[model samples]
Target chain A: MDRTIAIDVSHLSKTYDSYRAVDDLSFQVYAGEIFGLLGPNGAGKSTTLRTLITLLHPTSGAATVMGYDTVRDADKVRTLIGYVPQERAIDRFLTGREHLQLLGALYHLTKEEAAKRIAKLLTLVELEAHADRPAKTYSGGMKRKLDIACGLLPDPKVLFLDEPTLGLDVQSRLRIWEYVRMLKARGMTIVMTTNYLDEADQLCDRLAIIDGGKIKTLGSPVELKIALGGDIVSLTLKETDRIHSLESELKDRPAIKAVRATTKGLDIRVESPEKALPTILESANRLGCNIEFIQYNRPRLDDVFIAHTGRAITESIPESETA
Target chain B: MAHYWQEISALTMRWVRRLSREKFSMLFTLVQPMLFWLIFFGNLFQRAADTQVMQAPNYISFLAAGVVVMTVLNNGLAGGVDLLFDKENGFLERLMSTPIHRTSVILSRFIFVMGITSMQVLVILGVAYLFGVQPATGILGVAMIVLIGMMFGIGLTAISMAMAFSVKSHGDFFSVLGFLSLPMIFLSSALVPLTAMPGWMSFLAQFNPMTWAIDAVRPLILSGWTEALPHVGMVVLVMLVFDALCLYGGAKAFRRAMG
Candidate 1:
C-alpha cells in the first residue's frame, strides 16, 4: 500500500554557537508508519527530532510536519503532533488524573470531551486503577504511561518521541513498545529516536541510521540488511600474522562486499553466510593465520551501521546519555 | 476553555491545586517567614509606642503596612520557583509545545500570586485589627493597602520569573534569591521608619519599590487620604514603570529559553 508522506525534512541544520548538533540532515516519514531515527548518543537524532517537533528551530533548511512548516507554522504544526521527550515530564505532585485533565484543558477540549478522553487514555495506559493517585507513587513504567497520555491529549496525527525508552527498564520499554505499536495500528504516524538497535529493528518499519548529523543509511530493517548484504563473520587470529593477507583475499571474493579489521579479528561481510564460511576458513588456513576463535552472526542493524560508518556502534547507552 | 479568561483561570487553577495538595509547604510559606517580624519585632519595639519614634499610636500599627509588603515580598520573590521547576521537569517545554497562548502562562502566575497574597494580607490586617489598630480611612483604606501590595508584588514576581528563565540552574536562582530578598526587605521601611534609618539607607529606600508601596499603604492606615494620596499616586506611577520593565525582560528571557 502506498502511503502519503507525514513529515518532510530537507537539509535541516541546528547549531549551538560553535557546536553543530544537527548538520544538513534530512529524512521523510510516511503516514501511519513508525519511522525511527537510529543512532548512538549525540548522533544528532534528538536534535533532528526536536527540530521536527518545533522545540528547537533549525539553523538552516526547512521541515514540514503534516504539510505545515515547522518554523513558520509552528502553532499549526503543534496542533497536529504530540511530543514525548526523553525525560520524565510528569509533575509528581499532581495526580495521574490531574495530569491528563490539565493537558485536556491546554488542548481546549470541552469539559465533557476532556473527561471522556482522559478516562479512555487512563484505561488505555492501564493506569485507570491509580488515576487519582499522585504520580510520585507510580512505578517508572506507570509514570511513563502518564507522560504518553499527556502527549496524546490532542489526538495528533503525527507523534514525536525522542528517546522514549532511553532510561526505561525492560518491562517499561516493552509496555511502551506495545503502546507505540497500538498507536501505529490506530493510524498515528510515530517518529521516534532510539539508541537501542533492537528497538529500531522491532518497532520501526523504516529507519534512518544517523551519525555526525548525516544519514549514513536509510531503509526498512530487511531492506537495509539486504542492501548491505550478508552475514557478519568475525574471526580472531592467534596473532596479527597474515591477517592483512586474509582481509585482502576476503574482499576479493564475490560474496564478500566489505571487510574491516576489528580489535579482536576481521569483520567480513558475506552475501551468504553458509556459502562463504567454508571458503573463509580455507582462505584463513591458506594464509597460515591460526584462528583462535570464530563467530558467525546474523546481520543486524549494528552490522549495517558498521558497514556504512566503518566503526561499531558502542552499545553502552547510559554513559553516552550522561555525556 | 475556548474563552481567553477561561484558559487563564484554568491554568491558574493548576498552581492552586498543586499548592492545596502540599498543605504543609503552603502553610509554612505563608506563615513562618513573617512570624518573626510580626510577633518578635512588634514586641521588641513596644517601647516606641509611648515615644514620638513613629507617627502611629503603637508600634504594631506602625508595623502594619510593613507586614502587608512583607507578605507580598515572600510571595513574589518565590514566585519563579514553580516556573524553574517546570523548566527542569520539562513541563514548561510541554506547555509551550501546546496551542495555548504564551501570555497566559505569565498572567496566570500573576493571578495566582496575587490571590495568595490577598489571603495573607487579610490575615495580617485581621491580626492588626485585633490589636486595636483600625485604618483611618476605614474599609476603603484597607482596600487601597491591598492594591499597593499587589502592584509591588507583580513587579517582584516578574523579576523572579525573569531570573528563573535566565539562570543556568536552581542553585543559581536561589543564590540570587538570597542575595536580593533580605537586602530589599531591609532597605525598605518594612522594619523601621524612613526617618529612623541612617541617611544612606534612607536615600536608598527612596528608590526601592517596596518602600514606596509600604509608605503609600502606611498613611492610609494611620492618617487617611489627606496624607496618603500623594504617596499612593507616586507608588502607582513607579509600579507601572516597574511592571513594564520587568515584564519586558521576563518575556525576553522566556522567549530566549524557549528558543
Candidate 2:
C-alpha cells in the first residue's frame, strides 16, 4: 500500500474453471524501475501483466498500479498506465502519424497537443521518415516501433510491455532494448514480461523467474546467477547410464554440489568447475567411459530455471485447461 | 458534454481519414446500397406501378424516402463489424486501456455511420430527382427526414455494435444481419402500403418503428408536412425506445467484453 510502489500485487490468483493461470502471486514494482517478469511460454507471465494492466480481473487478491486499485479504480489506472500487448495493435489502414494522433485523442489531448506529441513520439521511435505511410506498408520492426510510439502518446507513469520483442530480429530487438533503457533513464516505471533470457539479462534491473504460475525465484541477474553456486560443468557421456555413476562418485566430492543428467550430457553444479573438471574427467576415464563433449561456463538464467523447475525452459508446456 | 463532443469529433475524424485512405473499400461499401436504391428499388417500383399498387403521385419520391432510411439503417448496423475487426486485431484492447470515455467509442461509431449514411442519402436523392421524382416541400422537410433517418440509424448502430461485442465470430454477424434486415424491411411500409396488406400484416406494420419512420417522412417527400405532428411524434417515441435499448445493451456488452 506504499505510495512509492508503482505496482502492488498481493496474493493474486486467476483461475479458469479448475486450472489456475496465475496462482497466489505477490510482487511489488517500485517507481522508476524496470521490473522484468521472466518465464517461458504458458508460464503465466502474460497473465500476471494483464492483471496488473486491468485487462483481466484476478479471481482472488488485488493489485494496484500507481496507487490506484486495478479493478475499483480502473479508469484512473488506465489514465496512469500504458499497455503494449504482444500483438501489433496499430491500425494497418491508418498512417503511423494518424495512429498516434488517434491514440493521443483517446488520451484527451487537443489537436495541437496531439500533433506535438505525435511528432515527438514518431521521432523518438525513429519512425518520422515513414510517419505518413500506412502501417501495413511498414516492416516488422517499423510496426513494433509504431506500437511503442502509440503507448508513449500519453506519457504514462507506468508502462506494461508484454513480450515486446517476441518476434523481432536481433537488430530490431537491440534497438527496442535501447529505447527501454532510455525510458528507464528518464525515470519511467516499466513492467515488462519476456521469455527471452538474454532480454531479461540485458534490460531488466530486477527480474522474477516465474514457472507453473508461481515465482520460482526473484532477484537481480547477478544475484540469481550467484545463487546457482560457482560454475556449471556440462559433460556429454558416450552412454546415458554413466551419468548415475558419475553423479554417485561426485556427490561426496568437496568441489561439487550436485550432478544431474541433462539431455545432451551430465551437468554438474560445483564450487569451481575449473578445479573439479580435471578430477571429474579422470574419474570418468577410470570408469571406462568416453566424454563426447565437455563445457564449463557461468550459469545462465536458463540454468537457474532448470535448477528450480526441474525442466528445460525451451520444452513445450504440457496443455492444461488453464486460461 | 464537452468531453462527449470532443470524443465524437475525434472518432468522426478517425473514420473519415480511414475511409479516405481506403478508397476502394469505401467505394465497395457505398456502391452496394446505391445499387439497391437505384436499380433494384427502381425496377421494383416500376413493376408496382404497372400493377397500380403504388398510387402516389411520384413513386420514385416515395421510394426515395424509404431507400434513404433503409440505407441509413443498413450502414449503421453494419458499422459494428468495424468494432469487431478492431477487437480481433487487438486495437479495441488498446483503445479500452486509454483514458477516453468508453461511451464515446460507441457514439463515435454512430456519428461516423450517420455521416456516411447522410452522404449516400444525398446521392440517392439526386438520382431520384433526375428521374423526375421531386420533393413536395423545401429544404426544411428534407432536413427533417434526414434527421429522423439519422436517429433511427444511430439506434441500429448501437444494437449492431452490442451484437458484435457479444458474438465471437464473423459468421454470426452475417447470420444476424440476414435475419434482422428482412423482417424489419417487410414489417414496415418501406416497399408497399399498409392498406394493401392483410389485417394481421397491417397490425404488424403499426408496431414496427420503421413503419412509423417511413410514414413520417414519406408524406414530407411525397405530400409535404400535411403529415400530422402526431405521426412524427410516434416515430420519435419509437426511435427513443430503440435508442435506449441499444445504448444500454451495447454498454453492457462492452463492459462484459472489457472484463
Tens digit per residue, CA lDDT, model 2, A18-128:
788889999989999899998878889888987887878989999999889988998899889988878888788888988887777778788899988888887899898
The CAPRI category of model 2 is medium
Clashing pairs in 1: none
- Superposition error at B79 for model 2 (Å): 1.5
> What TM-score do all the candidates reach, one by one?
0.91, 0.86
Per-residue alpha-carbon lDDT of model 2 for B14-65, expressed as tens digits? 8788888888988876765555665666766674563356657645655776
What does the lDDT read for residue A162 in candidate 1?
Answer: 79
Most accurate candidate by DockQ? 1
- Give lDDT tens digits, candidate 1, residues A1-323: 67799999999988876677788887889999999998888888888887887878888999999899988999899889898877888888889998888777777888899999988988999999999998889988888888899889889999888788877899989999999999999999999998888999999999999887789989999999888767888899887866777888888787676788876679888878888888898888888889999888878888888777667777433322211
Supply every candidate's count of residue pairs whose N, Cα or C atoms clash at under 3 angstroms.
0, 0
Q: DockQ, per-model, please?
A: 0.60, 0.55
